[model samples]
Target: MKRLGVLLISLSVIACQSEKKTTGQTDSTNAGTTSSSLTYKYDSLQVFSKTTTAIDKGKADTAYAKIVYPIFSNEQLNQLVEKKAIDAAGDVDSEKPKTYKEMAASFVEGFDSVNGEPDMGQPGAWFLDDQTKVLVSQPDYLCLEHSNVSYAGGAHPNSAMVFWNFDPKTLKEITLESLIKEGGLPELNAIAEKIFRKNEKLSPTASLKDSYFFEKDTFSLNRNFTITKEGLKFLYNPYEIKAYAYGSTELLIPFSELKALAKPNTLLSPTP
Candidate 1:
C-alpha cells in the first residue's frame, strides 16, 4: 500500500507544461498587444501539486491519513487556481475551493464522528490513506482519478475510486450531455450496454440477474468518463455496476466507434 501511495504522488509532477506563452514586446505600447496577442493552444497544462497528511495520537490510540491532488495553474486556461491556492494556504472560507489537505481532514473528521472516540484500551492503530493522480492532462481536457482506502476498527479496509474530467479552457466539469450530439444517447447507451455485458463475461442472451450487477437488473452507462487522443474511457467504481467483490470495470469506446455520434470540436472528437 505504501508503494501504491508513492507511485500516485510521483505521477502528479510528470509531463506538466504551460500551453500559452509570452509572444509580444515589453514596451508600454506593446503591453496591450502582448495581452491580446498571446494565443492559447491545445496541448497540456502547467500543474502545481501538493500532498498533505494528518496524524492524531493519544495516550493509547493513533490515526493517520493523507491526500494528493493536482492544481491547474494557467490563469487563462483555468480560473480556479487562485481560489484553490487560497484554500490550500489555510483560508477559512467554507465556500472557497478546497485543498488536498482539507479533503484528508474531512475524511479523518468523518471517521471520528462515526466511531465516536477511539478506544484508549485498544493497543493497535487506526488508519486512513488516500491518493489521487492526473490520469490525463491535455490542452483541451483533463482527467483525474482518486483512490481512497480507509478503516476505523472495521472488519476490513475499504477502497473506492473517484473520476473527474474537465474542460481545461473554462475549468468547468464535463458531462455526457456535453460530449454527445443530440439524439446520440440512445446509440451510445446501446453500444455501452453491449460492452458492459461482454466485460461482465455474460453471454448475449444472459440476463443482468445472472451476475451481481445492480439488483434492479437495470442496464445503464456510468456518467464518469474521460477523453484521450485515442478514445473515450468509461469507468465504474466498486459497487457502481456490480458487487464490490467484482471490483471496478473500465470500457474504452474508440474515436472511430463514436465518430458519427460525438459532437465535433469537443473532447470526444479526434484531435487534429
Candidate 2:
C-alpha cells in the first residue's frame, strides 16, 4: 500500500432514531423471538472523526473518515447489543485492531502516506466515509449494517459492507448454527449454488471450475446473513467467493426454504 500525507480534524453530533415493527399483529407467543411486535430505539455515538491532507507545491490532497455507531437506549436490557458491536469492531482482522473510536482515528490519522512524486501530474488525494445503518430494530433482535468507501491513489476506490446480528433478550450474537439446524448446511449450500448458477447464467450441468470464483470447484455459503420478514439474506463480500471484479454475491433464502431447519421459537418462523 502506497503511503500518502495526512492531517487530522474532528466533528461531533447527536442523533436519535427509533424503529418499531408494527406491520404485523402483536404475538405474545413470540415475545422472546423476533416475531414479537416490539419497539426498539437507540442512541447514536459519533467518535474518532478526522481529516488528513497532503500537499505538493500549490496543490493539496485530503481524506476524511469517521465511525458512527449505535448504543441501545434500553441499557439494562440491551447491554449485550452494545457490547457485541464494540467487541466485533475492535476485533477486526489486523495486526492490531483498534476500538471503534481508535479505529476511526487510525483511519484518518493514517489515511495514506506520501513519500514519492505525484502520479501522472495528479496530486495524491483520497477520502473515505463510513456509517452504520440499523437493518432490523426489534425488541428481541437487532441487526446492523456498516458501509465504507475508501480511495487511495489507485485505478479505482473500493467499498465494503459488513453486517451484525444480535439477540437482545439473550445478549448473544446470532450465528449460522443459531438460525439453522446442524443438518441444514447441506440444504442451504444446495439452494445457494442453484441461485448462484442462475445469477451467473451458467447451465445447470455446468461446472463451477469454469467460473472465476476462488474455489471454482467448490460451492460455499457466506457466513454473513441478515434476518428479515422474507427470510435470511447472505452477503458475500468481494474476494469472499469470487474475484473483486465480479463484485459481491447476495443470496436470499426465503423462510419457506428453511422452515424445516429453522430453530424453534425463533425469528425464522413465518410472519403472518
Candidate 3:
C-alpha cells in the first residue's frame, strides 16, 4: 500500500509540471498574436500612399477626382506621413537603358515649323540684339515675344547640351580649354560655339557667315546658374522687326510687297 501511494504522488507531480509548462507557452503565443488595429491600419495606409498613378493634364475633369481621393482619405487616418516626394520630369522610357540621356528632351515638344513661327505667317523676322538677347517681336506690330529652349542632349560622357535654342545658329568659336581658364561656361558655352561653327561651315549660302555672341546672365528668381550667351544670330524675314547681331541684313517684304515677288494665283493650284 505504501509503495503504490508513493508512485501515485510522483505521477501527480510530473503531470502538474507538464500542465504548467503548456499553460505558459499558450499565454506567450496568445500575447504575441494580440495586436491593436492601429498597427494594421498604419501599414495599410503606407502601402496605399506609395502607389502612384499619374494623370494626363488634359483629362483633369474625368480622372482627377476619382484618382486622388483614395490617397487623401488614407493619409487623414494615420496622418504620420513624414514626407512626400516627386520623381524626375518627362517620360520614363523603358526601351532606353537607364542613363542621364533622359535630360535631352526638347523644351518645345513636337516643333511644327510649318505653323510659321506663331503670328508671323504674313512675313516676320527674328534676330539677336547687340547684347545678343533674343527678341521675337514685330518691329512695329504688337504681340507676345518669348524664348524657349528648343532642344538639349547628352552627346558624350561628361558632355551635355542643357539647351539648344533658335534652330542652332552658327558662329566662330574658341578653344574649350581657353574658355574654361577664363571662368567661362566651359561646358554649355563651348557646345554653343561648336554649333555655330558647324552651322557656318555647312550653310550653302556664304553670305550667312559665322559670328560669335556670348553673355553671362543670372536668370530670374532663384538665379541658380549664371548663363553664358555662347551663340546668337540674326534672321530677317522682313514682315516684322527682329533682334540680331552685327552685319545682320534681311530682305523684308510685307504681304502687299510679297505680292510683287511671285504671283500666288499663277503658281498655286486652286482647290476645287
Candidate of highest TM-score: 2
Q: Each candidate: how many clashes?
A: 1, 8, 10
Best by lDDT: 2
**Between candidates 1 and 2, which one is better according to lDDT?**
2
Tens-digit lDDT track for model 3 on 78-193?
12111110012222333321211111111111111222234322221111110011122121111111121111112211111111121111111112222132333433333433
Task: Give candidate 3's error at residue 67 in angstroms.
Answer: 28
Q: Give candidate 2's TM-score.
A: 0.69
Model 1 — TM-score against the truth?
A: 0.62
- TM for every model, in the order presented, reads 0.62, 0.69, 0.14
Model 3 vs. true fold: TM: 0.14
In model 3, the runs with Cα more than 4 Å from the true position are: 1-251, 265-272
- In candidate 2, which residue pairs get closer than 3 Å at backbone N, Cα or C atoms, i.e. clash? 3-113, 3-114, 4-112, 4-113, 4-114, 5-114, 7-52, 7-53
Give the winner by TM-score: 1 or 3: 1
In candidate 2 the C-alpha lDDT for residue 271 amounts to 52
Expressed as tens digits, the lDDT of each residue in 32-71 for candidate 1 is 2112222322221222222222334634444455543343
Candidate 3 — worst ten consecutive residues by lDDT sum? 61-70
